[model samples]
Each structure stands twice: as C-alpha cells, then as structure tokens.
Target: MKDADFSDLLLIRKGEKDLTLGGGDSALAPVVSIGEWEARKEALKELYMLTLGQAPYHDIDPDLEIISEEDCGAYLRRKLMYNTGADERISAYMLLPKGLKGKVPAVLCIHPTTSMGKEQTIGNDPSSNGHDRAYALHLVEQGFITFAFDLMSAGERCFSGLKDFDTAPFYEKYPKWSSRGKDLWDVSQALDVVQSMPEVDAEKIGSIGHSQGGGITIHAMAVEPRIKAGVSSCGEWPMRISKNPFNAARTGWWVGRPLLRPFCVTGKEFPVQMHELLAMAAPNAIMNISALNDCKYTVEEKEFTGEAFRNMEENARKIYQLYGRPEAFKSITHLNGHSFLKEQRKAAYEFLKQHLFK
Candidate 1:
C-alpha cells in the first residue's frame, strides 16, 4: 500500500469561521446616558440570567447552621453550613471582629483554584499554594466581617466523588444548569446570609476572589446588584480567541471539552463579550486586578488582554461617570502571575475599605 495519501482532512487546515464575538466593527461602545445605562443593565442581566440558567425560581431557605466556633485573637471564627437553594448547602467560615460595635462592612472572600475549597479562604487547608493565603482572616483583622464558602464543586460539596476541577459532569447532568450560574446564585445567597447577621451592615457588602473565584466574582457582581463593590483578580480577562481548538495553548484550562463546552459552540460565542459583563457591574464601586504575567495568557494574548482590560475599564467608567461616581471603577495590573499575590490582595482590601467602609 502506498503510504496513505492523506490530503483530504489533515492537509486542509482552514477552520469554518473566525471566533468573532466582539472584535473590530462589532466592538461594543459605551452607553450614552443614565437612562440608556439602566435599560442596558436590565437587558444584559436578563440575557445573562437566561444564558447561565435563570436564578432558581423558588426561594432558598438559607438554612444557617453554625457547626463550630473559635476565638482566634482579633476575630471569632465560626464554621457554618447554609442552604443556598432548596437542597444546595454551602459550608462556610464566618469571621466576626472582636470589639466592633454596631453593624460593620462585610466581605465574601472567595477561594481560588483549589480542591480544598473554603479551607483556603479561611486559612484551614494548610496547603503551600501561595494563592491559598488566609484572605478572610486579613479582612477580619482589618475590622470587616467576612464570609468564606466552598464553591459548588469544591470542598465539602464535591458530591460527585471527583476533584473540583472535574466540573463538566455537573454541567452535563443538568442541561440548563451551569457551574457559573450556580456559583453566581450562591454569591447572592451568601449575601442574604450576611445581611441576616445583625453584626453585618447589609448596605456595605463587597466580594473579592482569585482565579476561579475571581471569574465568579465578576459574574456574581453582574447578576446580583446588591454586591456594592467587587474585586476580581486575574479572572476571565481574555474575550477574543482564535477559534481554532489549537488555541487551547492560549485559552488555558477553561476551554476544553465539557467544562466550558456550553459556551464554546462552533462559530458562535457568548451573547456578550466579557467586557460587557464588566460593564454590567457599573455604577457600583468595582475593581479589576490583573497580573501582567498571569499564567492564563500568552505574551501576545496578554497584550490583547491589556488592551481589552483598558477597553473594559473605559466602558465601565462611562457608566460610573454617568452615575456621578467616576472614581468608583478602577483596574490594576501587577507583575505577579496567576496567584493572588500580596499587592493584589492589599489593593482589594483597600478598594473594599474605600467603597464599603468609607
């Protein structure tokens, strides 16, 4: 047999169409006025709700149960589990400062890419990953009440007997359900639990997360307006991609078969680019934290992301400006990699302090 003549499929390297969600002529522009902003916000929220699966229609009881409590110097730490939905329970750590009186600002400290889940946020995991620093403790020490919870597929909630990174099964099981949507709803439910606390100032709630949690933070703020301020660290910054599966080298771990498959349909893209998602958090004090060398993007991809970040900032700024709070939206880029480094952490804490506390 002649060495297999293989010009049919392997030799022709052209793809069906380019990934053109929001690029060139289709780029989104800043909305013109407050009225326009309001209209756009409502439409975008509804669109995302549909895309990510509508928020559970029924009420979630938020069954708050404190399993354990401990006095840890500057704060009191309590381990609790609460129902974020009819049957969805979230295990969390609630930190309350020792001597504070009256209601105080509260923050939801979301964990990064870790199987240990809420443990990383509360300093309980004891893992060496730099991203797992005890951010909740830092917030409590700074006099802010804080809550940290296991994201849906992480920690105690990983009922599938698989690692947290293995999230596709959950998505596959529920056709209309998405990990992102469930995570977003959990954030809202977390806010509900925080507000119910007499020591928490319901009007002064903020959220901060890194990596996986960081991406969720953006979506959470977009869907839940009650999040008064948010800080997203090195999450979902890349909006445009080459459409070629080979581009996996640049898309990182999120674009593979099954994980983000729902959003990765051929020739089509998410109804809105992520920058629009950033804009969805407009009029609220929000900050985007980026690592110049975050492991998620290649050098060229980083340049593309830098430009995109600037564009997103400008778009979101326009909304904040229309609301007469131009200073409320900010983006900070650092030299760190994908992990939640000290600089980003400090910046997040300061941003939350400026908006939620002041």
Candidate 2:
C-alpha cells in the first residue's frame, strides 16, 4: 500500500520575491502554478491565486448537538454551528418556508465584521444600510430557507456594547468567560443542526456571509462538507500580507490590537489562507463579490485585492473542474467597494438555484 504521508510527494520551494507570481509586488497578484513545484508550494500557489486560505488548523473533536431553541417561527434553531470546539455556543438562526411540510434547501449565514466579545451582535445591525437581514428575508420570500444570527461578538452576546444580552444573567453569574471560543462553537453546532434535519436536504446546504461573517464562512466551509456554496463579501483579505481587511498578517482585524507575527502563532504553526478555505467548497459553486472602490483600503490596494481574490476564484474552479465541473465556482466585481451589492445577491440566488434546486 502507498504510504499516507505525502512527505516524499512534494516540497515547499522558496522563490525570490522578484520571481513572485506575475512578478507583481502586490500580495493580491496571481501567479501561474508552475507544475514542477512541490505539493504544498503548488497548493500555496493555487491558494494565492484564489485569495482565500485553508483552515487555520483542523481539530479532531467530534461533532456534537448541544443546543436547541424552539422559540422561532422562523428557522429551526440549533447549535452544532461550530463543527470544532474551537468556538462555543455559536447561536444560529434557521429560517424555513412558512408553509413548508417537508424537505427544503438551506443556507448557513456567516458574519464577517465582528468585535472583541459577544457573538450575537450581528443580528441587530439589520437597520444599517448594508445589513444582511434583507437578503435573509429575501431568501425566505423566494421559497428558500436561511439561518442568520449573531456570530461570537456582534449581536446579543456583545462585548463592547453590541448584542442583545440579558444582563440579569450577567449579574447573577458574576464573571462571564466568553469572547474566546464563541464564534467557532456556533459554527460547529450549526453544522450538526444542518446535518440532522430531515426537512433540510443535507446535500444542498450552503453558506453566505459578509465582512467578519464572510471570513467565518470561509473558515466554516474549509472544515465542513455540508456547505454547498459560499458568497464572501469584504472578508477577502486573508491572503494579503499587507494592511487592512482581515489581513491579520499586518495589523490584525482588531485595529490597535497587537498584530500576529507568524512566529508568534503557537510556535510558527501556519494558518491556511482564505482561498484554501474557499477551496474546501470544491465541487460546489462559490461566488466571490468585491468592488474596486472599496473605501476600507487605498485605491491602488483595492485593485490588487481584486486581482488576488480572482486568483483564488479561478483556482477553486480549477480544482472543482478536476471533479469535471468547471462551472462550480465563480467571482464577480462591482464598481463600488466593501459592501455587498444587489447584483451579487441576484447572482448568488441564481447559483443556488442552479446547484441546489436543480
């Protein structure tokens, strides 16, 4: 039998900076994957092209269904949201068809922009101009089901005055030990819910997220097999070793917070890129949306970011194409910046309709 270890299968070659992909100085630029490279290096080249990364790390913890709330007339509420125990009790919202009697399609909604603590704060911002509720509600209206809720630190469990928490419990329990493991927890727990439901077609479940949620979506898909498709917004900054967005490699998502030096990450254990995370969705359709004028970063940098994410998009297609379906992945651009656009939404629904409903 062939040894499982791929050590002899490939090596990580370090090329000069000037020999970078496309010879572009911008981290977002793409490079041709010279087939002669080693396995990880080839994977890295493919990952760099897509602009997303593989999982930061994979956990061995088994999936467990630990929470279920029956209060919503909306989604079937549950918490196997976080597949791994890295995060905890990540509250999830499952919106099903109003008059549904049986199985239906479902989408796991992820929130990209988040704060220090309190995972549920994402739900309230629906009143904001770019809030995701409109899309979630729109999904409901389209005879589809969606689950949208606060991630670790945004909505009800908020850290810096964000979520809709019941402070009475805080006063009753004293020190609340959260903030650290809430995000990943919700994702795994939600995964359990998706897999266990008879009304949900396990093969058709998908995910869509913006900002911090988008980043989480990338992470979730990297580790979960149920996610059939993903639409990522501005959280496409993981691959760039520069400033702004989720490129924690530079300034970290929490501005002013200490930046993460590669060496400082648990004795140099490398985290996967966002593109690699996207690749975990192989054989599934993915739509990456970005705008050239996003104000989050400087103008020139935005273009570079776009090119980099496109590399990820194309690479994902290449992999899925190996499964013999080149149309399983895609990328789109808007003239605007940072925010998810209507066109992207339209395209997303269409992709879902094609892959899931068809």
Candidate 3:
C-alpha cells in the first residue's frame, strides 16, 4: 500500500519481553451469562471441533492444490493448485519472501470479503480491495515469513461462498458434500502445511486477517496453539449481537448445533462471549483493528471486542504480571467504517512489530 501512512504510529523496536501469562486489565472477571450462567462447556468444545474437520491434514491428497507461480517484489509467489470439489479448487496466491533466510517467524494472511489470493496482499494490485495496505505482504517485507491461503468458498476455495465452497464430485454422490463450514477444517490443514515447512519458525508463528479472514484467524488461533499471536482486522472480536456475515458463519452453526447449543447457546444470557474465549489466548500478543466509517463495523461490535479483550487482560494478570504487559490485548479503531483505512493498517503493522518481532 504505497499510500499507507505510518507517520502517526509510535514505532518502537521489540525489546521488553512480556512472558507473564494470564489476568490483567486486558482480562475480565469471569461472569455467568445474564441468561445462562452455568453456560455450556460445549461452546468452547465445539470451537475445538469447529476449527478442524474430518479431513485429515496428514493425507497424501490435497483438496486445494497450487496452480501457478510468480515473482512479486522480494517474494516467490505460488498460485494454489486446489479443488475442494464444491467448485474449482480455491484460487489463491501464496507469497514467500526472499528475506526469510531460514526457519523464519511466519504469519498467515486472511482476506476480507473478496476471494483469497489477492494481488493487493503485497500492495501492488489496484483492482481488488484497494487499501494500499497489505498486511501479509507487509509482514514479509518486515523480515517475518508469512503464509496466505484461500479458504473454501473464497478465492481458490470456490467461486461460490461456503454454501458451495468445495466441488469434489463425491459431494455429488454424497449429502452436503461442500459446507463452507468445513472450510475451517481446510484452514486447519493449511496450518499443517505451514507447520511442516522447514523454513517456518513453527514456535513463533502468527495469523492475521481482515474482516472475514479476521473471523477465521480468531477461531484458528484460539484452537491452535502453534500460532503464538493473532491479529483481527475489521474482524469482530467483540461478538456483537449484530448479524455479521462472520458471526452467523456456517461454522458457527455447525459448531453450535446439537453439540454446543442449548447447553452453550444460553439465548438470553451468555456464560461468555467469543471475546472471552479469545481472552484465553492471553500472554500471546493480540491486536484488533477496527474502522469507524466501515458501516458494517459498529460501535456495539467493537464494544464486544474491546470489553472482552479488557476482560482477558485481567484474566492474564492473575498468573503472570511481568509481561504484565496488560496492554497486549488492545484495540484501535479508525474513524472510517467497515474497511481497513490507511491508519488502521498502520496500527496493525506497529502491533505486529512490537509483539512478534520482540
């Protein structure tokens, strides 16, 4: 994003390490939901089930495959050769930066509303979600290796959204062969690939996404410990009561149905919100990016994210106080709406540099 403005960010090199874990201003006091205090355990349990699917990550065959390769900037780009069978394989562009000399700290880039594999991820493309900001690509330029894959129903996942994310003919012979809900499982598999890579520093890994990608990143980070940090851009971490496409995601239905509902759904009350669950990811660096003009992003929406983050920081401080870096769980909002404006992206970059690099 050539037009991106980093002038406002208080840039600081990573120096102090906050190893302290659990409870601080970032955390909230555990509370029972107004409607259902007992709260069902299955919600989180379902979350565990939600991020993964029956699709085995160790299998020889891959639903999403790489189709092409290119060189952009200082990174090696590979087009994902993938076909989940719901449609064609998800069309995605993977970038491997030249600066990443060896087992490098890695990050996963998730896109907003459009398909995955955006040429703009690195900031050169103009046709796609033109923000002049590419978090995935920006991270690579910063010296940390990163991964960006198309989710089912997105980019290479399929032209269709989750309803038809995969196109395997077997789905033709089967029932609900392609539920984008299973895409999270697809992401889980993607993690396996990232983890398996010899050049990726598996221990210092992270995931960052915008909007829709933000939703997935939060879920993935919560369930997968391999990711040490998570950044949600224009993503709703607060779990507002609004009907966000991200909140009503098929994955939510899939996980909450039968298994997490009734017990965890506490309709009138919530034992905890999605943010509370995320708080469990304390001590791990976290940054939430929100835009004001992006109409889809609301005050209520951010409140949920902010309150939850605040609560989590409190939870984190109870155990470890040195990293007492209670400020880790934080949020920054742009006056603009639903979209990630220039300032928003800059905040994200600064946050990552502070935590991941440090």
Candidate 4:
C-alpha cells in the first residue's frame, strides 16, 4: 500500500523473473542407483565445461627446467619452469622428501590470492606472517611430495606491473576466453607435472588449498579426475553466487562478475546446480571445511551458506553412497572465521593421508 511496500513488490517480481530465465529447474532429481548417478555426473560435468568456456591448449612434453634447488632439511625444493600451453609458461616449486626411494603420494598445493602467491605456500616468503602458514612445507614434513604453482595474475604471472590484478584487460584482449577455464586448465596441467615426477606416486595425487586456493581445489576435483583426494578450506560454496552477488563479485574477480545475473544477460544460471558439481566428483575422497563465523559472509549469510553446503553434501553423499563408499565425502565446520587453522589443517592432512596413503 505504501511506497516502500510497492518497491519491495517490484524487487520480488524482478527476482522471480530472473530466476525463471536462469532456468530455475533444480539439479536435485532423485537418483535410485549408481548407474543413474553416473549418468547424472556425466551430464553435469559436460554442462560445467560449457559454463566455464574453453580452456587453453596444453603441451605436457615441455622440458621442465629446474632453475634452482635448495635443501630444506626434511625435503628438497626444486624451483622449476615449464610451458603449460603454447605461450603459458608456469613457474612452480616441487618438494621431494630426502630419501623417498619409490614413488610417493603427491599434493598439488594451490596458493591463495596473495602477492607472494606460490612462495607463501612453499615456505619461501617471509612477509606472509602467520596467516599464510606454509601448508605445502607441512605436507612435505608429513612424507608426501608436493607441487605449489603460481596461478595466473599472481606471483610471477602478475606481469602487468599493476598493484592489483585486473582481468578486464584479459577479457578485452580475448573476448571468448573464460578466466575460470584458463585456471582450471592450468591446474589440471599441473597434475601432469606431478605425474611426470619420478618420485611421485601419480595415482595417489591430491590437492589442498585455502580461500581462492580452496575454491580451485573443489573446481579441480569436479573437472580433473587426476586429483584422487581434495581438501577445500573456506572456499567458494556452490550456491552462494546466485543469492549473494556482493561476495561473488568480491571473490570472483572480473570474469566472475558476470555470474551475478541481471548484471550480465549471458550470466544466467549454471546449466547444473552447484550440488551437481559435488556429485560429479563422485567416488573420489573430498573434504570441505567451513567456518561458522567467517568474516567474509555475515552471520545471517553464513547460516545460508552453511545450509547450502550441507544440502550439497547431502545430495552428493547420495552419489557417494551409490558407489558404496559414503565416507568418500566428508565436511567439517569450526567457529573460527575464514581460515585454514591448525586443527582444520590437521584434519585435511589426515584426510589425504587416509585416502591416498592408508
């Protein structure tokens, strides 16, 4: 009846119409058995690939040149550079235990969005303080070989000399390219590097990451089967984007901007719901760590985020159960804000150890 009430009505109507255009069709169709789950997973995987756009080309035979090597007591760190595509050269650090005779389990330690990037994860950066504790070094201490690589626009790849990464330039230069696709391809190729190592047990390779690093861990698991196990700490939750545009834009960067509907016409709903992505990772061991009072999302928002993750876990577990390995999917939540704290870190390590080593 009043002006405020009329405005609310308009907002609600707009939201409803947008949802319809985004294909409000739910991804949570009932699955009766493993065969049905398998078909669903295949369909979801195909849709996800389409949503992410095309990934760059890969050349796995590039000569990985080790430019420097250092002995870090528990492990040997070798800094290496190689080409992932025709023009995409990657710089990464490989940590190998001192006396690993046979092939050992390996982890692709993805780095968070930091200026130091891979150095922070590999324990070579002193400026990170306590926030960016070297988790990759910890993995090496736990007797697993590890590889930490710089994501695009981070570490050495931030070649623009700008203070912050601006993906707008990239999109302008290559209109059809997807940032998420390029990143997915890059990390997938990193798996190739892990498998190529003589000391790495390729079949037992896993990945762990914090924040954006954690977000990629989930994405990598859904798309990259080479990752046998994965741990995502305070990463992006599947259903957060459509509802929370602010957080999505804050975390997603330029390319992620379009995911907020009405902002970009093409950025409607994903062909499959976020839960389906988890389902796509079926049979593989995956662990999601959530923080109850994360600073990123408000208290009310966290409640929704937590519920979304729980729902995803529930639906994804159906697929895992169909495989007769329900324990493959696990989730943990703590009161601490967004972080991969000591207790959380330990749980991730034990998870990987259990699945990949035990």
lDDT (Cα atoms) of all candidates against the true structure: 0.71, 0.53, 0.54, 0.72
lDDT of 3 by residue, 1-358 (tens): 0121211111112222441343333422333332221122334545556433333323433555557777776777766655433433445555677756567777778766664344456555566466544777777777777666655444544433343333343244433332333545556556666666677777777888887678667766655667778888766533333334233423432221122234334443233345544544555777766564353545655554444444544443332233355666766655556666667677777777677776
Residue pairs with backbone overlap in model 4: none
Superposing every Cα of model 2 onto the true structure, what RMSD results? 10.3
Model 4, global lDDT: 0.72
Question: Stretches of candidate 1 above 4 Å error?
Answer: 1-30, 54-57, 130-132, 241-263, 299-303
In terms of lDDT, the best-performing candidate is 4
> Candidate 2: what lDDT?
0.53
After superposition, which runs of candidate 2 have C-alpha atoms over 4 Å from their true positions? Answer: 1-91, 112-133, 160-182, 244-260, 263-271, 299-306
Q: How many residue pairs clash (N, CA or C atoms closer than 3 angstroms) in each of the candidate models, in the order given? A: 0, 63, 59, 0
Residue 249 of model 2 has an lDDT of: 36
TM-score, cand. 4: 0.84
Q: What tens-digit string does per-residue lDDT give for candidate 4 at 1-358? A: 1111111100111223355477544343355666655665676677677666554454556567889988988889999888876666788999988988899899999887677888888777676243445889999999999899887777887758554344665566555656667678788778877798888888999999998788788888897888999988877654433444444343334454333444334455445544555556768999988775664456656565566556556656767887888999888877678777789899999999999997
Q: What is the Cα-based lDDT of residue 291 in candidate 1? A: 69
Model 4: number of clashes? 0
> Between candidates 2 and 4, which one is better according to TM-score?
4
Off by over 4 Å in 3: 1-69, 79-92, 116-125, 159-181, 240-266, 269-272, 292-327
